[model samples]
Target: MDEAAVKEFIGTEISRSTVVVERSAIAFFASAVLDDDPVYTNADEASARGFEAIPAPPTFPFVMQNWGAFAELQAEGGQGAGLGMVLGPLMANGGLILHGEQAFVYHQPVLAGQTLTGVGVIKDAYVKESKGTTMTFVVAETTWSDASGAPVVTTTFNIIHRK
Candidate 1:
């Protein structure tokens, strides 16, 4: 299908997946990213420092949740318009004002060995004209919570599909 055809289909709710947080995964994330924060690395240090356990960095959940959602969306026959299609208008366009703006409220710090479930949904979609072409923006919002039903985090993303 063409870009406009896909853009028209943008408003559909895409997919959702749940992720269980694991200590090993957290450790690997911290180490791979070269983050030496004790709250993410050393459990003893975290406990000694008065945390429940090693807590993940604020943006760490994105690593675990967003990519999976994107993969699922693509696998379900979504096309990549471009980097802007995957990211947003700023990155796709040549504007110097591109910024990553995500608002997340953590009800509880993610602790080591805790399995957090992430529930994702494609929240909204719309088309906007840019220059001489049309761009479709899809917003996906995902909420993560512990098994006990306590909220963990929520991420709303804008994916722009250009035609």
Candidate 2:
């Protein structure tokens, strides 16, 4: 689809997937963050501290939410203006900034053994011209909830498609 067609598809509900939080995944996340916090690493310490299981870091939800949503979109053959395209045009015209703004709200901390189902939708889209290049901005919002129906987190990411 062309840019306009893609924009028209904005606000369309896209995909949903369920992810089970495993102990190994949690440990991997902890290692990635270099977080020495006992709450995320020491299971015994976490339980002693009254946590049922290791509490995932705040940003950990992105691993399952953002990347998962992107994978879903790509699987559906959605066109994406990649980073290379953004940089190539910018380099030709001195430079340009493609800033991505993300905001999230956490209703509950993710814990191991819990299953989170993520639902995502395209929220908005528009285009702007700067320095002789057109930039299409798409905003998508995703909500994740645990199997018990408790809200886990919500995220919104702004993607810039440059031309």
Candidate 3:
């Protein structure tokens, strides 16, 4: 798609996935990132530090958002979908995908075993036309909320596609 077509998707809903935040997911993420914070995987340590449960690390929601991508991939019968899968359509042409920036805002602590739903939307899409090449900047945000519908986290992802 060209710039106009890409911009038309600015307000489109990309994906939504809900998962019951659990110990395994949190532990795995912490280990994979080499985060030594005990609060992310040990309930006892968290409680000792004044937390009611094993609290998710600050960047947990960002990783948790991948559930939506994986779900979409499964629906399409793809072999597998992990991180970075949400941008499948945009990257179909082998364009250079750069993770530009990321920001996070947390309204409340996300604890283990809490059912949370996250929805991703195309917040902004703009194209930078340069000589002989086109670059697109896509900013997507995912709002994660608890079962009661109260937003607990908001994450902004800035992705750049160069073709």
Candidate 4:
């Protein structure tokens, strides 16, 4: 991909999605992630643990976009263009698009039965040369907020394009 294209993608809104946090989905996610915690499956257990409801496993928000909200957005006439829009150029160039890193900053515990809206932006993009290979790193940040419009969590992930 050219520098001009990369520059254009940086700081752009790549994705917007809204997800409903279902109790069943949280339980399923916990099982999938190998977290067999009682609080994730039983509301009573979660209540004893001082939670109002069953809490989603950590990293659950990462799937909120691709698994549900993105599909909904797509059905709404491609409103949620998502990360694909940001990585399309790099991917079209016949190179590898790889996940580099992911991080989450939680302002509140995400519990079941709440709705979250997320907006992701290409925060930064740059290129590095290593061992004669060109590597482009893109940083994307998404902020998830509750229905009341308060921030719930902020997630930052890096995608690397290598040629």
> Which pairs of residues clash in candidate 1, taking residues 3 or more apart in a chain or in different chains?
none
Clashes of each: 0, 0, 1, 0
Candidate ranking (TM-score, best to worst): 4, 3, 2, 1
What is the TM-score of each predicted model, taking all chains together? 0.66, 0.74, 0.81, 0.90
Could you arrange the candidates by lDDT from highest to lowest? 4, 3, 2, 1
The lDDT, on a scale of 0 to 1, for candidate 1 is 0.60
Q: What's model 1's TM-score?
A: 0.66
Query: Model 2, stretches more than 4 Å misplaced?
Result: 1-4, 65-99
Which is better, 2 or 4, measured by lDDT? 4
Question: What is the Å distance of residue 133 in model 1 from its true position?
Answer: 2.0
Highest lDDT: which candidate? 4
The alpha-carbon lDDT assigned to residue 156 of candidate 2 equals 81
Greater TM-score among 2 and 4 belongs to 4
RMSD, candidate 1, Å: 6.7
Cα lDDT tens digits, model 2, 1-163, are 2367556657676656667676766777888888877778788987998888888877787776433333343334343333333234334644344557888898977887777777777788777778977776767777888877788899887776665
Per-residue lDDT tens digits for candidate 4, residues 1-163, read: 6666677888788777787788888888999999999999999999999998888888999886645553553325454577788677678877888999999999999988777888889999888888988898899999999889999999999989999
Candidate 1, residues 1-163, lDDT tens digits: the string is: 2345444444444434545556767777888888877667777888998888777777778777533333432333443232343344334454232233455666778776666666555565555677976655566666777778788788666555555
Which of the numbered candidates is closest to the native, going by highest TM-score? Answer: 4
Q: Please give the range of 10 consecutive residues that has the lowest summed lDDT in model 3.
A: 73-82
